[model samples]
Target: MNTADRVDLVTRYTQEVVTDEELAELLEEDSPSAYIGYAPTGEMHIGHFTTMRKLADFLQAGVDVTVLIADLHAHLDDEKSPFDLLDARSAYYEEAIEGMIEAAGADPDDIDFVRGTEFQLEEEYTLEMYRMAAETTISRTQRAASEVVRESESPNLGGLIYPLMQNLDVKSLDADIAYGGIDQRGIYMLGREILPNHGGESPVCLFAPLLAGLSGGKMSASEESSKVNLTDSPEEVADKINDAYCPMGEAEENGVLEYMEYLVFPILDERGENFVVERPEEYGGDLVYESYDALESDFVNEDLHPADLKGAAGEYVSEGIDPIRERLTEQPELLAEAYPDKYGDE
Candidate 1:
């Protein structure tokens, strides 16, 4: 596929489009690089998968890709990160990141991994980055891109430098596009505005919708109930989806239903309502429909109960994890080392 088609596929999957022929032409004449950034600060959760899948899709469409581990940002965000902890637990977190990426079916060769600090310090980039970071005020930086900063209790120097360094990553890589979640919009906008001052064109930003946790809010790696980690077992995924806050007979404005609409529904191509699990013995098995409208109409009209939908969602979520679970089971040693606390208990 050409660049335009590739952009379309990414936009379809992510619903965030950041490419245009004019912009693409400018990038081609200017820098001609494309990359996807990842903050490896926490266990790679289902939330991470949404972006990783987009990154892979971008690469499949022949875009050059870079996946940053963002270790330095992890430390800057909190003093308690695995890197700061400097214990077995910290190393385990790092390994878990690698394992989770591999389990997610990300191509190892396609990813250009880097530690944030090291990437910043390479050549004159580090010195230049420090200078750029110094020019931007804390208030401007905070207002421009401080989601992570606001999330921190005591935003430190690293928190302030985080966006600057991230912006520097785009300039340093000379990338044509940068991918992040909607939460990173402010920082990404900062990159677009500030990067050109340092002689690099601003990378067009693509923001994927955030996936809510099972209990129905932003998924947090720190909160067990708030996320489905990549390491979760199939049964765990099923149970979580089963108990998820998917309101029945309602539109997707509901967070849980929105998760189903954006993440789950798109994966199926057809509407999820079409695949009906007919319980009647006379029916012999489930009845599948080609149109989502029909299925949704049946659901909203009380023809289908919420439990039936949950059952289907549980099965679907379970099946989705089958391959990932197989990879995890095959790497028992890796799992033992990466998740010693959880795996050891079992």
Candidate 2:
């Protein structure tokens, strides 16, 4: 692909790119690499699936990709993933991510996967950590990680060091681009500022938009009703999508529409298929949409009912996640070990 096409692919559907100039220059290289980190603290959900879908775009543009399973970072973030369960959770995360990539119509073999403990505990990495700590203030560190780490009136020392390790990770991983959700902007911006002093260059940052919750607000991990789990059965997925916040002739804060725009349409497009919303003969039968824009236009004009949109979205969403659910089901022990309290009995 040409430079302009590559740039479009990289920036498409993203919330923001740190600098368009830097991204253009980086894409000019024979082989450019980008990395995104995810701490395996909770079950892989549909929200995470949306972010993973972007990797297909990077691969299509010929950009090499790396996924960082930040096990240590998970523990430091208020001990969300207990130290003893880190290995199990990390294993589950890697498999789930691979499944997501394949479901998005991309080959998982093209990407490299790295674990935090693989190099974070080394002597050289440890020395740099100390140097960064000496140069950074507690207040600065807290500010950088405020949106990411759990907030406490008296934060633990581990929380303070979390951002430092993240900064160092860019250098250690040798990434040309640091990709994540927009909530990570603060920590990455801090890395761009201070990484140079620690012998690393500022990376091109790519941030994805966060999807709204099905229940009507920000998607939260603690609230089961907010997001659909990766392992949810097709019936469960349909029920959740049926109960999602979708209003007739209105699109604002509609999770069902967001899922169609972000997840369903993209996956279907990749597979060379159209989105089909089935209806009875009296309701004008089935409606086929080759693009999300056309579908949204019909809905806004009141030509389509909210019930029809929700029913279609649920089917497509369920279809997209079926492969992931099947893969995880083959290894029940993975989930049982990773989250014994929740999946042990099952």
Candidate 3:
């Protein structure tokens, strides 16, 4: 692909790129690497799948992709996944991520999966962390990790080190681009500022847009109905989307439309499939969209009803998630062990 084509591939579905100039420069190189780290904590939902779609984009653009299962970070971040459950959760996360990659129409075998403990314990990495610690003030570290680590009056020291380790991960992994949701912009910006001092190059950052929750506002695992779980059944997905806060002809804060644009449409388009909104003869017949923009335009023009859009979105999302749900079902023991309290009854 030419530079423009390659740049389009990388920046197509992303919310922001650190610098288009830097991305263009990297595209000029023979090979550039991109990496994203996920702390193995909660269920990998449809929101997380959106980032996987970007990973597929990078792969198609000829960038080497690395998936970092940050188990240790999960351990250090107030033990969110629990030390004992880290291995199970990490294993589950890898499988789910691979499923997501495939759902995005990318080959999972082409991607590399790395565990945090693999090299985070190496003396070279540890020494650099100490160097950053010596140079970085506690206040600065807290500021960088503000969005990530939980804040409190007596926050654990691990909270401060979390962002530092994440910063170093780019250098340690030798990645050219740091890909993540926009929330990590703060930490990666700090990484760009700090890494050069330790002889590490600042990574070009690519960010995916955060999708709104079904009920509106941010999507969180804590709010069960707020996000669609990878394992959600067809009925559950339909129910969630149907009851979701989607307004007629209003694009703002519509999670159903967000999924249709970010997750469902991209995957469907890549697979040479059409997005069909089924309706009876009375309700303007079935609206078929070969592109998401068409669907969005119709909705924005008030030609499409919210109910019709929700039904279509649920069906498309379920089709995309079916394989993932089946894959996870084959390994019941993984979820059972990882989230014992939640899945033990099953």
Q: List RMSD in Å for every model shown.
A: 4.1, 1.1, 1.0
Candidate 2 lDDT, 200-287, residue by residue in tens:
9999999998899999878899888778899999889889988888888888888888898889988888889999989999989999
Best by lDDT: 2
What does candidate 3's lDDT look like per residue over 4-111, in tens digits? 999998998789999899999999987799999999998889999999999888988999999999999998887788899999999999999999999888999999
**What lDDT would candidate 2 get against the real structure?**
0.93
- Misplaced by over 4 Å in model 2 are none
After TM-score superposition, the amount by which residue 24's alpha carbon in candidate 2 deviates from its true location, in angstroms, is 0.7
lDDT of 1: 0.61
Which portions of model 1 miss their true places by more than 4 Å? 2-4, 18-32, 84-107, 150-154, 252-259, 265-278, 281-304, 332-346
